[model samples]
Target chain A: MHVLILGAAGMVGQKLTTALIADGGLGDQALTRLSLVDVVEPPAPAAFSGAVDRVAADLSLPGTAEQVVASRPDVIFHLAAIVSGEAEADFDKGYRINLDGTRFLFDAIRLVGDGYRPRIVFTSSIAVFGAPFPDLIPDEYFTTPLTSYGTQKAIGELLLSDYTRRGFFDGVAIRLPTICVRPGKPNKAASGFFSNIIREPLSGHEAVLPVAEDVRHWFASPRAAVSFLKHAATLDSDRIGPRRAISLPGLSCTVSDEIASLRRIGGEAVVARIRREPDPTIGRIVAGWPTNFNARRAAELGFVAETRFEEIIEAHIEDELGGRFVS
Target chain B: MHVLILGAAGMVGQKLTTALIADGGLGDQALTRLSLVDVVEPPAPAAFSGAVDRVAADLSLPGTAEQVVASRPDVIFHLAAIVSGEAEADFDKGYRINLDGTRFLFDAIRLVGDGYRPRIVFTSSIAVFGAPFPDLIPDEYFTTPLTSYGTQKAIGELLLSDYTRRGFFDGVAIRLPTICVRPGKPNKAASGFFSNIIREPLSGHEAVLPVAEDVRHWFASPRAAVSFLKHAATLDSDRIGPRRAISLPGLSCTVSDEIASLRRIGGEAVVARIRREPDPTIGRIVAGWPTNFNARRAAELGFVAETRFEEIIEAHIEDELGGRFVS
Candidate 1:
């Protein structure tokens, strides 16, 4: 099977690329070609016996999306987006890249009109749900995003559903929870602390706890996120019906719970590495985010995530630390 | 108050214009200047001393939206959109007019900068909701529009909320129920029959009921619709928070209830004028529509509608039929 991966340079994209290369295919088809794209040139996956093409281009630019879709890959993984903090700070750039860029790609595919309907797997975010949320957000709750990034993702979900309903393409939008134990340095995303608190401690470094321990949030492992994308590409569209977007299953926990899990996996020393540093700006931004969700629809559709915070930490250690932490 | 109506040539637009002219202004302000725009040149409201400019322009085209916003009307009634059947049949035109046009206008207003935020009352539709619905769809129900028209309106609502939240404009999207006892002749909208059975019969003409009598739907009068726009323009945005879209309250009843109300208003002779010639295509389309809504939010916000089907029919007689039916 031919495959295309947008945003292939990002952490999740790189991991997804490695996973696809290792599997030698997606679903039941053997990989014959792989096209990877990002604003920056993505690295070539090592040891993959396929026709690989890596290109550095912005999808929002004129004709760039057309260039990406020209290959007519069987499945397209759209993982490109500006992080929340950057999008919030730069309004024009945010709308241009997140909203207009996505639309450009969708339109390009639509214009390919020779009945070429590829399976599109879009990465949406739980940020689509803003504050004043119920204790447990249900699958059918209204989306009233507070941030521009969330708004763009929400719009993308709408477009995906509409385009799929119109027979332009078979698409699935997975609203991923905050990916915890993210194996990377802290980023500018408002939700970055959810990962930094764990990743930094495991690496024998101090990490600031921006919010109170009582502050709760939803999470999924990077492994689970990649799995969600893989499953989405091959999932039965008939079962999904016209509602193409689904809130993926996730584990709900608080900062205290994360600390407890970190201590359990990496001893008290690692947990002690976390420093209490109150950052009101991040707190206020995170406060408006949803902490839990009743993702019954996604669970019933066979999407899975880490059940416990400990498991999430363990997965990170195994994947990023070669089965061990600094301790 | 300087007011602008984007689709001043359409039925709702014209009615809203007339109402605004008669009221002397919106809210407590007196009429100063009026700007009316549409793809066709709008008729000037009569007996108004205010400066009026009616222009034929397509908002989706370059610079058209900028020109419209140049006047910087205090309140903008964005009522332009191709009807459902037409939008669904002509895909490009629908997105261009409904989605792109609305976005262009919003962007134009945003570029006006200098804190020039106007009260933008956008006319959304119940089409934003899809079928296989609960008995009463709640205020927080997810938007999973099944038609292209519905999709466009849903996207517009997203843009409206985002733009409003960013302080670019003070916007409110009112999801209007199907206007019953409509004054004009039937158009191509699948929901056209809802008005036809009542409108044609009251005008001493035969009308076709395209679906079973048990087919239920939500509705309001053209008068109520106009009131919705006016109230939306003056409603306190502070109370609305970040979620700018609202489902307006309306009377929910079945086709049988409508006919029963017709009998009450125009006697059995008028009810007899209704012909049962079922068109399955329209029936299928209508079947996928929401039957009812729990518009408690709108009700709490003081948006009122007919409580009884008889009152809805009476409203038609009083407003459109000169207080008497053809009989």
Candidate 2:
């Protein structure tokens, strides 16, 4: 089987590539070729025996998407997007890259008429649901995104469903929860604090907690996110029906819960590295994000996530820190 | 006040134009100018002292949207779109006119900058909602549109909310229910039969009912639709907040209810003109449409509609049949 990964330079994309190479296949077929594309040139998987092509390309540019789809990979993982903060700050850049880029890719795939339909796994986010949400948002709740990035993702979901419905392709959008204990430096995303508090403290470094302890949100592990993408690519499209997007199952927790998980895994000394700094801007932005979801459809569809924040912490230690904290 | 109607040549557009002319203004402002545009040249509203410009234009084309926004009408009624059947049959045309056209107009308004934000009342449709609904779908139900027309409208709603949030435009999308007793010839829309049965019978002609009598659906009158647009335009943008689109309150009833109302309004002789010819294709399409909605938000905001099918039929008679129908 041939596989294509867009935004293959990103952390999740790199991890997904590693996992795919390790498994030596996707679904029931062996991986014979892998095509990776990103705005920056993506690295080739060192151990993979497959024919690997790494190319640097921007999807929003004319004909770039066409070049990416020219290979006609059996499955395409579209994870390219501008992070939330950057998108909100630069409106034109956000729309051009996040919205137009995704549309360009979808249109290019559609224009490849001769039934060259590939399984498309799109990475969406919980940002699609804004504030004033119910205690636990259901699978069928309305999407009223507060940010431009969320709006772009919501539009992408709409286009994916429509394109799939029109027989252009088989697509599934997995609306991932914020990946807790994200194994990287803090990013500009408003939700960065969700991971910063856990990742930094565990690394024996100071991390600012922007919101209140009681402020809750949804989460999953990076491991689970990668798994969601793999399962999504191979899942029976017939079972998904016309609503091509699904909110993946996630753990519902608060800052207090993360601290508790940190204490459990890294002890009080490590947890003490978290600094309490009430940044109202970040608090206000994060406040509008969805905290919990009843992703019943995804649960039934066999997409699982870390059941506890403690497990998320453990996964981070094992995967990112080699089963050891800086402490 | 300057008012611009994007599809002034269509039935609902023409009616809205006539209503605006009759009232001599929108809200409390006297009419100073009326800009009417459509693919076909729109008719000038007769005897109006206000400056009127009727132009034939396609919004999807380059420079057209900019020209329209150049006038910078105080209230712009965006009512242009290909009907459902046509959009589904011709995908490219649908995306070009419905999606691209709407976006171009919005972009043009935004680029005009100089803090020019007009009240944009976009006419969305109930097609935005798909089937497998509750007895009464709530205002916040997920939008999984079952048709290309619906998909385009849903995307438009997303853009409208995002643009409004960014202060690009003060926009409101009113998701109109099927306009029951729609005046004029039967179009290719699957729901066309809903109006055809009532409209043709009242006009002393035979009408085909292409579905079971129990097929329930939501509806409103053309008069109510015009009122919704007027209200949407004048309603305080502050009250709308970020969620700019709303499901308008509408009467929900079955085909039998419509026939009963038709009988009452047009007498037994006219009702007898209704012929039952169940077209399975149309039936399948109509089945996937939302039958009822808990449009509590719209009602709370003072947007009203007919409570009974009989009143809706009576509205058709008074508004379209010159207050009389053939016996």
For each candidate in turn, the TM-score is: 0.98, 0.98
Query: What are the Cα lDDT values of the candidates?
Result: 0.92, 0.92
Angstrom error at residue B125, model 2? 0.9
Local accuracy of candidate 2 as per-residue lDDT tens digits, B176-272: 9999889988887878999999888888899988899999999999989989988898898888888889999999999998888877767899989
Give one digit per residue, the lDDT tens place, for model 2 in A1-327: 999999999989999999999999988999999998999999878798979999999999989999999989999999999899999999999999999999999999999999899999999999998889999999999999999999999999999999999999999999999987788887778888889888888788999988899999999999999999999999999999899999999999988998997888788899889999999888888989998999999999999998888899888999999888977
Question: What DockQ does each listed candidate score?
Answer: 0.87, 0.86
Candidate 1, B82: how far from true, in Å? Answer: 1.1
Weakest ten-residue segment in model 2 chain B by summed lDDT: B258-267
The residue-by-residue lDDT of candidate 1 on B147-205, one tens digit each, is: 99999999999999989998999999999999987888777788999999998988999
Reference contacts preserved by each model: 0.88, 0.80
Model 2 is docked with a DockQ of 0.86
- Candidate 2: where are CA atoms >4 Å away? none
